[model samples]
Target: MGQQEWMTKDFYAILGVDKSADAQAIKKAYRKLARTYHPDHNAQNPQAEERFKEIGEAYAVLSDAEKRRQYDAIRAMAGGGARFSAGPGGPGGSGSFDDVFASMFGGATGRGGAGFGNGSFRFTSPGGSGGFEDVMSGLFGAGSRGGFGGFGQQPQRGGDLTSSTRLSFRQAIEGATLKLRVEGREMTVRVPAGVRDGQQLRLRGKGRQVPGGQPGDLLLTVEVAPHPVYSRSGEADLIADIPISIGEAVAGGSVEVPLLDGSSARIKIPAGTSSGMKLRLKGKGVRSSGKRRAGDLYARVRIVVPRKPSRDVTDAARRIDEAADFDPREGLTTQAGW
Candidate 1:
């Protein structure tokens, strides 16, 4: 095992947990710490978000069994009998393992192996060394090896920054662009058409600056505001309750209903349409970029009763009840309690 700063960071300590913590325990600790240090929750404190990021990175590694093993191994090796000996009268004299570890991993010479900077550790092996590169490659593949610090060699894209955005139900369904204020800069980002609540939208190359590398992305987590009259059922569907008068319910008529886009459409109410009857309007709901087709809007019919009934209305109802020969609950009774 090779010693690395990341290994010595003690992610478990940062999250305030023991190495024996289970997945659920790790997750709970991470969430608690994340909430405590979250940028939104700790606006005035500059270190809160950074600590939160640390917690996230810690959880990202510790949550996985293999990663946790590697991390533990690196920490053990870093703190073990690997004291820094002046590399045959090198620059620094005999020092603690920290100095040697730092000199070797700090990219001071960039001679290969792994280098640590920009809050992360990079492994660039010079062909040989029983380091993480070999273990990671054997366990995963070339793609996975890229994660350890080799492969693509292309400058890595900056990490995606996350923030939350609140959208009205209509806007979530109709799709809208949001102006996000991140790091004191306002950036206009497109919220894809038919985005759902809690859905994440990735805007590539919109994150923090990386030395000699392209900027990262901005990841927006959307929170859709509840609407008084409308609700979302899925990625591309809108649901609403439509009220119909007694006459309209019995006789059938075209009634206007509001769509998600703030537009109204006339839907034909069939004769004898009962309360709770659902009607679907094709292509009147949310629109998805991939499908390029609008989802159907569902309208549930709810019969509206008159607040004040006139004598004529009462008499007509009485006459209709008296004229009806069929009992609505005829089959509900059991024969002799059998």
Candidate 2:
């Protein structure tokens, strides 16, 4: 919305929240009211739909830290919900809103200068600097010399945009070219390999088009999906569980392990290897980057025993257990008074 419209709105009151409400409290109020008056929940009810829109508009402005500050400033300047008119005596006859701005920006007074005409007003300071558009650009965070177009409640300057995309686990490890819908337009983006979850990327000059100045940037966030077989750790290290038979753990030897590249590699399993032992395979994880070296893959050992063994196998196990005479939990109840 434009500056003029913003001055007339009571966003705090619309959301049924006090001016001192915190972000969390404001969010809670918005969610509760949105659920109650949403169009999906109250179909064919115009009043409910309008209420839902108002709630959304209020949240859109209040949820943003910068937008909320600007809105609050404008509301305060207008004496808390003041209506702007073409003539003098704004809101409760304090003075014309234009006159207030003219005095602040050092613009000329009376009609034909910072005055209203044809349902619109203009504020032009000396040397074309410190005008209403310049003040608005600063408030809206548009860069220097990047004032908004059509200051008389017209189209605004382009602002930075934000978006997020989801990537599969493999795609996160291996870079992929994706086409994403941003600002209602499909654009191609290249995601680097080994991108961690919640990483943000910035693209310059890819935001909304402005009338005169350069376009703003697009901030993209990446979300990596979980992998069923493998997971990541540290900067680029990968982890996986490798199941080995009990016999292999007892008499360890060379075994083939799976890799993310649809291949397998043989690694030696030390004799007398136990369950939960980790074996590191160098250069088997993520690719090398300028900032980070190539990572290693950790294979955690899991000893698997036979289920429902045959009679002969059961007899052999019983004999072996008797010969070993081993107590796995030797501490028993003496430890920790358990």
Candidate 3:
């Protein structure tokens, strides 16, 4: 952006935030406004599209600490409403604003260089060594080279875009490629394996395009649907709750557990296995893209007991309980004491 344009535009006002607003507050305001004015949400509305662009520009400047500071200084120095005239000293011409910068930097007041027409004037140093961008580079850091038409104006990068896609749990774990339409263009996106729900993927140079600057990126958020029998845990682990009878928990045996790929695995339950115990199956979880090993599967035990028992069954249970003589909650009082 040009210094002159920056002086005229109220970035804070555009974002509906105070000049003293913190970085988070500024970001919050920008997101809200961007969503409201986004082109996808406001088809055929030129005003909204323009507003969205303005909001993006404001955010791009305000989000960076150094850029915000420099912008504030410039606005304050130029009184927030200064305009650059098209010519040398005269009424409605290059005045105090131009003269102050020129005298301070020893820059000559002229026009037509840096591709600016006779109708527009620029504050440039002698022999085109420095212009507004050059001066800014000297003061802060280096600015955009050339000019607006000829390296005087900074290249305004296109705004980043956000979109989302839905995936089944299987697809999320195994990976899939799907097509998504963004900004009226259909793009094929690769949903990486082991991607968690609500994970965001950034696609560079896949956003709105501007004439003379770098294109923005696309922020794609993935939403994975829930599975009926399976769930996930840390990194790439898979979890499944397996139900076993009281006899199985006490004696223990092999049980058939369902796998994600329409198969089953025989898991051996150790003798006297208790409820809530987990069995780990190596190399049975979600697979990563390449080289990295797949994760493991955890089967949690849930012991089920009969709700209603016949007289004979109750008698047998009483005889077994007497023979075992085990107190399951023996240390409950002391262990749970505060």
Best by lDDT: 3
* TM-score, per-candidate, Cα-based: 0.59, 0.60, 0.58
Candidate 1 structure lDDT: 0.65
lDDT of 3 by residue, 220-308 (tens): 66668899778998887899899998678878899999998899998999989988899999999988777378999999988987889
Q: What is the C-alpha RMSD of each candidate to the true structure, in Å?
A: 9.7, 8.9, 8.8
Candidate 2, residues 49-147, lDDT tens digits: the string is: 677666666776787777787677677666743334333322223454445455544663333233344333433434552444454554465643432
Task: Measure candidate 3: CA RMSD.
Answer: 8.8
Residue 84 accuracy (lDDT) in model 2? 40
Best-to-worst TM-score order: 2, 1, 3
Two-way TM-score contest, 2 vs 3, winner: 2
Candidate models: Cα lDDT each = 0.65, 0.68, 0.72
